[model samples]
Target chain A: MTKSRIYLSIALLPLLSVPWFFGPSSSAVVLGFPIWALYSLAITLLFSLLLCWILQRYWSLLAEDESDVE
Target chain B: MSSEALIDGGGLVVMSLYFLSLIGIGLAGRFASREESLSDFYLSGRSMGLTVLFLTLYATQYSGNTLIGFAGRAYREGFLFLMSVTFMMAVIGVYLLYAPKLRRLAERFEFITIGDYVQHRYSNSGLTIVVTILAIVALGNYVLTNLKAIGLIVEAATGGVVSFATGIIALCAIMVLYETLGGLRSVAWTDALQGILLLLGCFAIFAAIEFHYGGLRSLGDQLSAARPDLWLPPSSAQKWGWLSTLLLLGIGIAMYPHAIQRIYAARSTDTLRRSLQIMVFMPLVTTLFMVIIGIVGLSQFPDLDRAGSENITLLILTDLANNIPGIEILILLFICAALAAIMSTVDSALLAISSLFTQDIYRRLRPDSSQQQLTRFGKILSWAIMAAMAYLAIQADATIWRLIVIKLELLCQIAPAIILGVNVRRLNAAAVLSGLLAGTALTLFLMLAGDPIPSKPLGIHAGIWALLLNLAIVFLVDRLRRPAE
Candidate 1:
């Protein structure tokens, strides 16, 4: 895997641990949202953006190869 | 408008037209393809571009379960069910582990079924048979469970005007008709529309819920006051449960037979990659919304039992339509989208089952059979399977979500075969075969004699335990055996 892929995978590790660490707490509200929910949504958004970055940076190399071959 | 009036009148009309359009697309698919080969029938001639590929993957992956079962689970489990979002994203992440390489292999080998890949990679017919049988069993359960959901959706959406038994038969008949007409092409084409509708319906419902209920803040306040436990962190046991679910669904769902077939059906590497990149973000839009709906349901309808909770999404839709002004059309659209999700999933599973039977079993049994003959057999098999499933759907007593989990448990065992087979060349056919059998036996044993969710043995999912044992057996056996010269 490329460095970016590895970094993204590492980034995702923390997202998976969000539930374990954040705990469901109603008192910890960020921007009128439960802490857990807000944390999850933030992680999800970050994961998406990071994934898009990985796709653009590394996966496009494969696409370019396909075009070259064609 | 009253719920009954909406369901029986405009709602029914819109759903009927949607069904008709599916059949029309099926006929169009048949006319569009020049060849009658299995590849053309089962894979749309491997000509699916990025858009169709993306939507079909989206539709097939998120079924009726996402809309109904997830919400029900969320309502029942509270904030803990947010793990659903993580598991769904994990499915996409898991795909990155094997899909790119597997698709390349698929293109190189002209692989039609996952069985073809197993047979090609391992050169073990017995292993191929075992893998194929596992896929069929898992997918058959898939069809059975979704068939039940279809009946429930139609019956519920139409305010029970269409009886459950009749709903199953009528909707299943429509699915089989179109599936036979154009196979994967028709399924994918219809899925594109269904996928769009599903997204639209989700957003519409969320918007309506926000408008009427003052968004998640009010709901959160109510939940905190009424159910403080729901706001607490999961216990240690629950954390283990969360990890187990993540691994089970993440790896398992990506290995779904229909999903693998979609990988094979991609037009190009670029198409598959693009679709997957977009797919990685889908849980954000799809499952996350459904989970929110369920969480909101906690405050809105505080006392629903397990079975009743599964109807939370529908119940909320109905309430909104009845009480809110001018949202009847949105309610109807959401109902149609729910049906679309269920039907899309059923058709994809049906096609996968047919292709697996015809390509893997029947063709192996009669190697002399032509592609045309195999295609015919596949069509006939679809009808037969749907008939059997519809019958079982009516008689079966398990909940939709439980049935889905059972399928995933069995399907996850096949993962080592495909995932390890692609990544590890040294893993022999014997190892994979033994691993598969052992994992399957352990999964069944645990499910039957152990916990209802099959995660009671040490709080981890039984499927994950089975997979661990499977890998252990594979590696141990491989170490003992010498490489072939």
Candidate 2:
């Protein structure tokens, strides 16, 4: 696997771990957002930014093989 | 005219024009394709750019259920339904496991369908056939469930002027017409428009809710006072439930036949990667909005029963149109967007089924058939499948969530063949085939024995249990066979 792919996968681990820290909590609101909602939004934003970075940098390095297209 | 009557008239006209434009795009797709080939028909000649690819992925991933069924679930489950956002993102995350490699292989092999990949990887016709049948059945259920949604939406939006039965038939007719007209090209083009409308509609409704019910602060305060339990942290068991759902939907959705076909349809690796990067964030705008809308519904209409809550989004739309000033246009647009979501899903699933049947089953049986002949067969198959599904949809009474769960239960079984086969070279075809059979059998047995939603014999999802056994069988069989030697 490429370095970026591995980085992306590791970044996704926190998304699943959301249940551990912020699972179904409504008592605490962060900046007017529920704890769980805020956690999710933060992780999603991180994921999107990381993915965009990977695509712009590492993804273009992969060689394209269009030999099979008829 | 009354407000309801005005909505019905305006919504019907907008939706009619929307449907007509879809057919117009289909005709245009037909004219643009220079050759009659399966690749051209099924994958739009593998020529999709970034914008169309991203939107098609968005449209297919977030169906009408995202708008209607998801909100209902959120209204029913409360803050716990925030798991919906996580799971939707997990679908994109799971793609990281295999999509890059699969895309490379697909380009090299010129793969058109998921079955093509299975056939190439396994070289076992039996395994290929079993996986293909599972895909077809899962996708068939998808079409049936969405057809039911279309009927309900039309019936409700038209204020019953269009009966449920008539609604199903008319929408199915239009979907099959355009799908048959230009195949994937047409479907992708229409999906772009639908995806945009869906996003707009979500924002419009969120604005309308704020307009009608003050703001999120007021709604949250009301909900906290009325239903404090909605905010409590999930119990250990419920947390497990959340994880199980994430795995089930994560792996299952990425393996969707239509999704894989889109992966193949991507014009370049960079295009596919960029599209997926954008897709990673859709849950925020789509599923998250639906959950918020549902929560707002809880505060606005606190006494709704379980079934009544599913209509929360639509009911809110109706109320807003009737009561709110200068919001009638937004209501009509939202209705069209909801319809767009449902139709986009139905058309994509229909096209995937037809391609699976044609390229994998029929063409395999008749290897001598020309590409043109196979393409024609696929078009006919699309119409036939839609007709059968429409007929069955009228009689099918399951909730949208239930129907989706049933499909995912079976579809999840194929994950071993797709994901494992792509990543693990030592796993033999026989191991994969046996694992698939055992997993599917177990899932069906458990589903038929009791309540279909919850996992049996354990707190985990039934499909996850089946998948565990499926993975076990694959590993055990692979070790015994020693295929690497």
Candidate with the greatest TM-score versus the true structure: 1
Query: Using DockQ as the measure, which candidate wins?
Result: 1
**Per-residue lDDT over B52-171 for candidate 1, one digit per residue giving the tens place of the 0 to 100 score:** 999999999999888889989988987778888878887876776677678888888999999999999899999999999999999988888888888877777666678789999999
User: Chain B TM-score in candidate 2, rounded to 2 decimals?
Assistant: 0.97
**How many Å off is the CA of B319 in candidate 2?**
2.9
Candidate 2 lDDT, B21-40, residue by residue in tens = 99999898888786899999
Off by over 4 Å in 2: A1-16, A21-26, A57-70, B1-6, B451-454, B483-485
DockQ of every candidate: 0.32, 0.30
Query: What is the two-chain DockQ of model 1?
Result: 0.32
lDDT of each: 0.83, 0.83
- The DockQ assigned to candidate 2 is 0.30
Model 2: per-residue Cα lDDT at residue A63? 32
